[model samples]
Target: MAAILSGDRLRFLLGRFKDRLWVKPLVVCLLSIVAAFIAKLVDGTTLAQHVPEIAAESVETLLSIMAGSMLVIATFSVASMVSAYASAASTATPRSFTLVVGDDASQNALSTFVGAFIFSVVALVAVKNNYFEAAGLFILFVLTVCVFGMVIFTFVRWVDRIARLGRMGSTIEKVEKAATAALKRRRNAPTLRGVKLTSEPHGRTVVATSVGYVQHIDIAAIQAWAEENDVRVIVAALPGTFAAPGRALAYISNLSREQGLEQKQEDFDDTRVVRSFHIGPDRLFDDDPRFGLVVLSEIAGRALSPAVNDPGTAIGVIGTLLRLLVLWGEPAVEQDEQAPSYDRVEVPEISVRDMFDDAFTAIARDGAGMVEVAVRLQKALHALALVGDPALRAAAEYHGRLALKRAKAALAMEEDYTAVRDVAMFSETGSQRNY
Candidate 1:
């Protein structure tokens, strides 16, 4: 019953394309041309006195059939495009869109996927019905549906990752600078101390601290210090470069204290391997985990954008994580050991991994390290958190690294050969043992 309703919806969406301009005619014309060619190519050209009559009848029949099929295909093509637009819009979060989509991006990709599916399905159904007697036609229908769906999927990905051409001329510097500035600010924290501080982009203030203790100066003067003295480095993979937190954008080299006083923004046409989009489709973030650095920058970008500073810390974080997971593939992080005694106060009875787990049974049954091991992992985060201080700025970093390290260790443990270890492939998947 549910399947029927879904089909109806799909058909209805595809039907909408029939009324579109140029779709009906184009489809009918293409099909007509092909059908005419087939009519000409077939063995039965004419049948004597009966040949003329037979040829006339055959051409008329073929042309009619071709027109009908063309009409259906035209309608389907339009529907697929519409569905793709919707699907692309749907999956996309409301990014600063400035960074990826646009600030007001919508999640409408589902409709597009459905549209494409519906379009392809309609074409298949037409083939199944009209070409039931022709084996070649049946094969063609199946191939068409598969190819169309794959194309739609690829189109959606492209749209999601890169900006449309209309906005090609626009600059992608806001988030670009944000990532670098944020990273440099954190990496060169010691220098930022003497860097003068001022209320600039709102919520966050720019601090003009020195690379080291410097001569006292006015806030206005310090503002230009970074620029005049040339204090900053050109962070590779600039802001919006899809970097993990703690990922080195660029390294700073020898610079006089005066040069370190001011960070200047230099514009250069970089023709190197610069990725405009960070979809993480490829294993892009396999090494660096410094993407967390961009979330704050994204927030700052939104808070200061031309379209009402809509800070997107969560969006940036999720985007970074999703990209990281997809590019490098996520290890079973939840399986890692937690720090020792970090959460031991109330969970003395449980392992850190188990305590964190929703179900205690699963954790204990797994081959993760002892609860004591997880406790130590948790303790490591806590200790590092304290040392790092400024909980907001540093705690998350320490904790994130701790979590990743522990998860990685746990996965390694699972792979290790041991007496109690479980390493068997499941019969159904031919992949690995479920347990």
Candidate 2:
């Protein structure tokens, strides 16, 4: 069955039409006028003898011809012009609208009229001595213009949609990159200038070190020395961190400060420190079930829990841990098993951090129904910004985490109504849930 288009749907279809591109009816109108003129001249000279009565009264005949011909041409012209407007209105979107300067609409309208005049004049000239016969050709000219317009408009939409897809794809890729992070071993470390190795184990032993590397570097000497000395080091430079050649990382022992530097260094600039680390088999210190749990407990106790935070505190802490491990120059997990073995996918855009954000958001605000909160939580990205947009996103995510942050607080305080009011205010599902 052929589906019937509704008024609104039809309008939508028409709006995308290119008005200037479809000025066919106007062209036909101009040709028709030319054809009519030719017909009048031929009829006077050739058919004048046969149609004496019609030709005798020249002023009357001229007036009648003007009125009848004008009425027919004007009706067709109005239909053609109106159709252009209708097509444009249907397809144009609010977001796609860029207010063009100058007078495009008026100019297009004028051009349409000009095209019409050309078609009308040409048609009348072609059918000499027979104005009524020329009128049939005029109608055919109008049909041809409309058909051409429809074909052109149909192709334009497909081209536009393809262009839009390309644009949206690029934007999404950038967003994806900004979201996922690097947990990688370093070589030609770029962003991180060098590493600062502090106090090692008491027994003069060093385990393998980890870090990220952005560029290429000569590490034969560094590797040979570490192997012979029985020391393990890590270089944790990110993928984009710039590293210059011949810059050696500094190994500083007995580092004295307000807080003792025991384990590994942090993410910092390139010019300050120097050192390269080692890579070993990936393994955790212990199979402690309590690793994430302990962090969550601390968070809950300090009001820093992700359940009530925008960027959930728990997820942020985990992300930081991942980042630190990366900086330590460790080999990250494989992105895909089938992917080349040369590299591991440390933080794909859709990451564990993004996952945790969703989980925390669900726990913070119990709003969604008929959906698995945990499944949704797994979609969070691994990318994090400590001081800037990352922090803001984290905060928003925390607020989205659970429904009972304040309630938990109020319940702890023995205030029921205040908790109720708080929950009500923040009960709605957060926008970040989609993220």
The residue ranges of model 2 lying beyond 4 angstroms of the native Cα positions read 1-162, 165-170, 177-222, 228-231, 234-435
Query: What is the per-residue lDDT of model 2 for residues 1-435, given as tens digits with 9 covering 90 to 100?
Result: 011243322432343233234444455455545544543434324443443233223322333343345446445434543443343222221111111111133334333444444543444344343443333433433333453363345335433432332232222222222223222222122212223323332322222234433322213333333333333323332222323343223232222221453533332222212332221122111111112222232332223323433233333433333333233233334444343211111111222344344224433333222122222222222122222345434533454334334344434333443333332323443222223
Which one wins on TM-score? 1
Candidate 2 local distance difference test against the native:
0.32
Worst 10 residues of 1 by lDDT: 341-350
lDDT of 1 by residue, 207-285 (tens): 2211221111121222232234433222233222334434433322214444554333332221111121122322211
| Cα-based lDDT for every prediction | 0.31, 0.32
> TM-scores of all models?
0.23, 0.21
